[model samples]
Target: MNYQAPLRDMRFVWHEMFDVTGHCQHLGLDLDRDTLDGILEEAGRFTAEVIAPLNRNSDEQGCQLLGTEVSTPDGFREAYRQYVDNGWASMTGPMAYGGQGLPQMASACVHEMLMAASLSFRIYSGLTEGAVLAVHRHGSEALRQTWLGKMVSGEWTGTMCLTEPQAGTDLALLRTRAQPQADGSYLITGNKIFISGGEQDLTDNTIHLVLARLPDAPAGVKGISLFLVPKILTDGRRNELSCGALEHKMGIKGASTCVMNFDGAQGWLVGEPNQGLSCMFTMMNDARFQVGLQGLGIAEAAFQGGLAYARERLQSRSLTGAVAPDKVADPIIVHPDVRRMLLTQKSLTEGCRMLGAYTARQLDLEHGAPDPEDRRAAMRRAALLIPIVKGFFTDVGQEVASLGVQLYGGHGYIREWGMEQLMRDSRITQLYEGTNGIQALDLVRRKLMGDGGAELHALVEELSQHVEAAGHQPRLQEMAGAVSQRLEEWRALGKTIIEACQRDPQEIGAVSVDFLAYSAYVLLAGLWLQAAVRAGETLTDGTGESAFYQAKLQTADFYWRRVLPRASAHREALLGGANCLMAMPASDFSC
Candidate 1:
């Protein structure tokens, strides 16, 4: 089954939730309504016609591994060429670096389309953009002059190498060594694993932002430094690096996740010594949202595929007179249970899309807004939403993708249907870019508790104002109230946990993930409520946009009715205390 782009839903989010035209005006961008519409139309066409066709083939053909060389599946190189030619890569880069200088919100539209069409192909470009941002912010002029232009044009690619086999989540444990040389270059030697697009034939050279340790660096995370190790050494010219081997993974088989062996590889240091963590962190928050969108994209793909199949596939007749009495049976969608499943997928996908895009817009405001106070406020709001976008989206993504497979029955499990592949590709989103578990812990421990829950309180209070304003619209009022109530519960619960953690350090970890998940549900619901208000107004007019707006409002209701209610379980788990987690004895179940 082929997945179609949900351009209508995307447009609704852009116009109703984000108000793209007004936002562009705020940014000093002079785009009119027609221009924004044209951009989305073109993006939809490119993804559906150009990128979607390559997804299955890339999965089937997979990446090729030959000795120390790796080749991506056919058409990837050409697709990338077309992508850069279309100026998509430059959309979010700096204007000084040959970029289009578009806001990140506009870039989110392109990102959603490409991600929904083909994640593996887009991963290469996504990583390069992230790496370029880091370099542009911190690299020396000579470094920027030499590489930024081509990277912005997609002539070369980039990767972030921070994870090693033993140092998966703990960056401090990394053993990759970077020894400084007399010429200001360093020699990096270590094995970096799970490096996506690390070694591929799509580009002329790959630039790696590597995290390694200097000889006299301090211990733990503060000691790590970042280096720029290109696959080709250019002393102002030369190519000198070898691919080690590509990892065989469950999905995204087309993306070459390679184990790179750098043996005295020529490298230039980035940022100051022992400050690499801060340097590489320039892109972490944004990268986390991208991974979250991966989950959203895959979930949307699965939901669309399942909805299409359910509307047509016939199985058993209805208890009442069949709507399809002429046929042997009624459509599977007639069943209440099946309707529930489809609604769940639809609710989660559409809702998560709003959450991700709104978060993107917040990031845009944080960076591009004229007012310093507004920028700081936007940054704080973004901090509050990032974990939700990452954790809640991934959790729902897995559930929705799995439900899509279930909807297809046996056919879904089969490779030809591609349902199973969607599940596989989405699973990693939960694990990497800081696992959902880690994200949750960060929320409860760092973001929420470090300031004595001051940020959390401020966010809740800000949303409360919106809830108060929404009282006139019954649907919006109820949704906002539900979200507000949950936030209150979460706030009280967070306070209790934070106070308990002061007495027992281990208590924090045990309840962190559950607390994070619960908070995310409430956060997404807040965003959904905000969108529903506008969507409700548009649909009330009974115009062409009415159907689209009505659907958005209904999806918001679906989330409240089905998904938001699940937070009760998480709240229960969190308040249950950390006993079960801490009770497991070290020798109890030794393998």
Candidate 2:
């Protein structure tokens, strides 16, 4: 399984759609063409040669547990060593803390390649980033000094410990308790479930950023505090608690998902006593985007696999003339249906890649841009897109992976083909890191409603400008038109959902998921139009790879033609409100 990344697509997004050079100029960063090219080349090489090979082996071996210790698959420790040796783990951290200090756009490009090559293997390393960012942003100076350097270097690992068995999605019902110790430390006693990288032996120590309620704290997410509980105490060589058990899961089998027990564990507080929930949410937002990338990565891999298979696998004669008459059967590539699946995967994968990088670029603008107004606008845009980044990318991940399986027919389900693995691995991306449904609710209930929809109106209006600018390109024009139409529909549907919520607060529980899908479709469609116009420009230049640029153009067309149409029904479901959802009673769920 040799993996050649879509380098051409990445370059297109970086140079054309995202205006990376302009962004770098704005940031006072010296990222010339040669520098950017060298970075992408190195990242793609590392992903294909180093990270990808471990996927199959990791899936087969899974994680090993002995007593209180958990070890990752066969080559993980060595591979992780190489990953750290190359400074890949430090890309997003502060230069003062021994990090590479690369732009987030560069990091996003590298991440998509790494994840596409080996999502399961990358999971172990990815957790360290989000957790480190949380600590760097919110931790005390002493805490930052103690942990940031080592974690950034991958000498140690980190975990975000939220989600108890009973308190998933709803933090108000959490039961974990943190009792303060006289020594300024705390004693944590709680059970954490679905904790990724929780108790892995891939590093010297695993730091758990646990959210627990203090003994004298308030109730319902107010009292939740973030604690830095290391597997080993300060001395860093003793086990304080135990890995209760490894979760037997549906996907990303190589990454250890653990049910952990923190029984009177010695822990130091990461932030203010009662500010843990807020602190953890900062990490969650970062993790949410990364998890969305998990979907994008797996989907890219599946798309590549499907494309290769379609080119070579001879299944039937085409309805049209024989493209490969020499072969016994026509290559699957000749068939319209096969092309549909391939185009769907390619378009979505490319669009999502650009969207992810666009989001990353916005993050960079928010963080590094000189103008305060520009920073504020970029931050707002990033906030608006986060839900789509988290919800839309992951949903398409499952859809694209399933399409990969479909392309393989019966062979896809078998272990050898690896299509099923793609589907299985991507399934959890939508489930965890604040489920897609929760993401939708956040977008509509929180982000859109802010300042009485001023931000929403601004974003939609901004996207409308992009659409208007896309008038010359037919594909872009169509995508722009469709998305603009959907936005209006979404606004109307949003008002209906809001009205329903006013009547019955539980209306959210009914319509959140479908509403999320609808919102995601609109956002993705807008992104597709943006990329389509960029691709059209590249095609006009005829400078480099015309075929690749043309492919992007055609895929964008396919998205508008085939994919965005689904938004109509999804919008209808949202407009239907809680009636269909609430009309059914709990009794109807009985078997």
Candidate 3:
């Protein structure tokens, strides 16, 4: 079977778990349940019908560099045109720019479907969304007038050009230059590597948000400025920039990763001079969160594929008894080990979707919440979750995809099965959008320290209330208690890390990944327990979705009993201090 869009589960998370309907209603979106349902169902059909079939072929054919331009694989450009014509591109764009003015949550659900269908195709649109956001938020009025409409309408696509040959994560060594011109435009001259869709046949123009330095500027990141250099200039002539080459990659090859050379490309400034990092960061958060969805999407696809294969592949009888008496051996689903792997995938993919929806909700509130303090609180919480959403999801995503491979045994390792493609594609999500390590350090330094952990405390308090709400129900009491205990431990660990950071700064990087993993587990524990709460409430209230709710409760039990205990190792490891890591000399490691 082809990949279904998980529309039912999307509704469960959006309408029931989070109540995005009411939230959007409050924001005057007027997006009713039936309307939202129609939107999702339609999008589901499109992705399953149009995008799903292209995955295997797209991988094989990939994108090709022809002369000075990059050509996407077969059907990519056509599908993208259909995607744009159907108004999918402007789902969450600015209303002023002829967009639908929907909440980010709505767009996020759609994106999850797209990512599951074709991550390669989704990459192109995801970059455009980020570029639109950067331009809408920080671009000057004139720049906005010139660019936003075209981008929102899908007449053009966009890219954020930041990385160079020498600079990957460190912006301090960036050498891209922007020379001031007499006519108020700047000449952007630089080389950017791994530019996704740097040159593509998808659109008439590409609006590249390039990060470069001015002639008279500071020597580090502070001096960097964001500039808009169109592939085709305002007068409709091709700009000086060209696609020098494309990277040969292990996966996501259908998406162009070009070596973009900007040769005195005419451009205009965005945001304040020397504040490019700050501006790009604002866009990066969106990009990273979207990458997190990519992780979730790939995991969902793997789970679907693995589950389908498990149901059909006969291997051995159940340990208890023969499940298929007529057959020589029972289907693999009957085996405990197979069930364990499938269950783990189900739990993580579904649990991460819940977490993703929650994060998206917070993001919507950050943008659309009317109250100032409400928006601020949502902003803080969203900032905290971005790394988790990007780092933890992708990390586990790889694990889940690998489990899918394991489910298939030897057949999974080869090309024909398509399970290994997910494993390869999922790997990049963790590496890019700031490696999971970078996300860990970011969570430690920025979100943790920004307001002295006020947001963390707020989250803890909210989880505490949910724990209390689940107190009286006998079925939920144990799970609630487990989550409650984790909440306390999570809070204590944060305090410990902050104190340790005061003593040694390297302590932050050393414990960062562990802490992130710990928090990811604890956060999912809270969300899972809360999902159980909702499920149980629905069950008791005679909502009649017994199987769905029961499965949710069972999964919550698995997460609490089987998965969450792993956080203990992370906690102890982080508490062990940085000495274990810092004591090792760099040169001695190679020996």
Top candidate, metric TM-score: 3
Candidate 2 Cα outliers beyond 4 Å, as residue runs:
237-239, 473-483, 491-500, 503-506
Per-prediction TM-score, please? 0.96, 0.96, 0.99
Residue by residue across 131-163, what tens digits does model 3's lDDT show?
Answer: 999989999999999999989988799998989
lDDT of each: 0.84, 0.83, 0.91
What is the C-alpha lDDT profile of model 1 across 1-591, one tens digit per residue? 575778787787888667888988887888787888888888888888889889998889999989988989999989888988998878777878897777777778678778778889889999998998889988988888888888887888899998998999999899999898999999998989999889998888899999999999999999999998888766645334566788878888889999888888889988889999999978688788888888888888899889999999999977676889899989999998898899889888887888778888888898878899989988888887788788888888789999999999999999898888888888888888899989988887778877788878887776676577667787677777788788788778778888988888887887888888887777767777777777766666665566667777787888887889988998888778777777889888688
Measured on C-alpha atoms, candidate 2 has an lDDT of 0.83
Residue 127 of model 3 has an lDDT of 95
What is the C-alpha lDDT profile of model 2 across 346-371, one tens digit per residue? 87888788789988988888878899
Model 1 lDDT at residue 489: 82
Error of 3 at 62 (Å): 0.5
Cα deviation of 353, candidate 3, in Å: 0.9
lDDT of 3 at 301: 95
State the local distance difference test value for candidate 3.
Answer: 0.91
TM-score, predicted candidate 1 vs. hidden true structure: 0.96
Ranking by TM-score: 3, 1, 2
